[model samples]
Target: MSIQDIVFVTGNANKLKEVKMILSSESSKFNLINEPLDLEEIQDVDLKSIAMAKCKQASEILGPNRPVFVEDTALVFDEFNGLPGAYIKWFVKSMGLAKIVQMLDSFDNKDAKAITTIVYADGKGEFHVFQGITEGTIVSSRGPTTFGWDSIFQPKESTNGQTYAEMAKEDKNLISQRGRAFAQLKTFLAAESM
Candidate 1:
């Protein structure tokens, strides 16, 4: 697919902004369509399934020519057997990050990670899936610069045990789950354009 023929479908403005910034920095030649293709949120599901479902929904709305991209991310904690893996959104909205931290306070393991899967479909049965993961541990307090659960999640071997929110934008973009997934997408698009 050509760069001018791509569109990103999402409802989160923050995520859109971050994606735009990343693409811009790479001089990525693609258009971003901010239209929100509605998808019902299914509880207690796997990340890949959620991504595929969203991709299908967006493709149906976009018709048979235009391509649409959708992503679903989940925070999986090793200590809790990946509790809230696919339910991170509801958990965050219902309990907030603070309460989640409190809930994990007594767990024997703090190892956690974020898994992001992006699905791009051309509405013609042609689709691609890209995934990114950031290995980290759960922190007790929120960081000043991070958004969402950023302040409460620290990457492994991080300096001062800081989370993505505590790291600079450049640094975060280098190792973030979204960053990794987008990088893979960028590479795929670049190759396809060749």
Candidate 2:
């Protein structure tokens, strides 16, 4: 089935927009839908499990006819031993990015990576999970054009010492965790359709 043939489920408008843009660039014939799922917070310790919980919730809400997709992502720092792995949202809400960077400053290790796990369910209890990862380091200062942790998080081996946020949207999309996951999803969808 083409993207146009599938109904995309999402509660976040920003994420929905980004996903739609990525899908459209790959195939204009695909359809994008923004259906919010009644998802609940999971008390799980692993990001993958949390993502599956969200997907299961969405699948239940969507019934048996529609397929729902849910994604959970985390930022793991080498020094912190993955302190914020599955609690990234909590960390963001409690300490914010600047404080997190300040806390990281005390450590000599700045190596980090962003991992995203995407769960897709067809409302029949059957699901698929896809993971995408991007390795990088945390920078000390913020950049002019980046948002969120974009200004402070620099990907490893990046040219000009730029963060994901500093790169153009197209460029970032090519290397981002979401990008990698979506690429895999596209391939899956294509194969399934055939």
Candidate 3:
């Protein structure tokens, strides 16, 4: 597992940048390079399952002799009982941030968590899933800096009550779900290398 580079099946440059940044900040001897595969998202309430599908597909397409990784994110709402849990991406695309906030107007319990599942698959076809969850509450979209549902999600770890979108990018890195998951992935990679 002393990999110098990995095939990350993603087309999103932002994701690639974040992963690259995370790895660069660490002392580990691994670099995440993009493969740019448009893997289909499978239906599952479990984020891990979705990630596993992506990983498996990426591994299969790239052959089973190489190391690759894929990530899936899900936004779970407490009051909605996770109605739009795994479909948060679709919701964001179809309904936009305003509708998401407005949907919770009547619900007092606005508690929510952003869950990021990062699945690493080597040539062995074994899936290693690292998850990161950040507790936060739904708030009105306040900033135009971040993308997706970030503007309406105020992470509990935020000191200034700013939503993830409102906080500085580097600051969000300290507490964001994707940040934490990749951090765990870093530790896992290091441990496996040993």
lDDT of each: 0.79, 0.75, 0.84
Q: Pick the candidate with the highest TM-score.
A: 3
Q: Is candidate 1 or candidate 2 better by TM-score?
A: 1
Q: Is candidate 2 or candidate 3 better by TM-score?
A: 3
Q: After best superposition, candidate 3 residue 177: deviation in angstroms?
A: 0.9
| lDDT, model 1, position 184 | 93
Q: Model 1 compared with the native: what TM-score?
A: 0.91
> Best-fitting candidate, measured by lDDT?
3
As for model 1, its CA RMSD to the true structure in angstroms is: 2.0
Pairs with backbone N, CA or C atoms under 3 Å apart (clashes), candidate 3: none
Question: Per-prediction TM-score, please?
Answer: 0.91, 0.88, 0.93
lDDT of 2 by residue, 1-194 (tens): 33444556666676777788677755654555677766786876577888888877777676756766887778888887876777876776787777888878778888988887888875456799999999999876556522446666787746777887678778877888888888888788767656
Candidate 2, residue 54: the lDDT equals 82
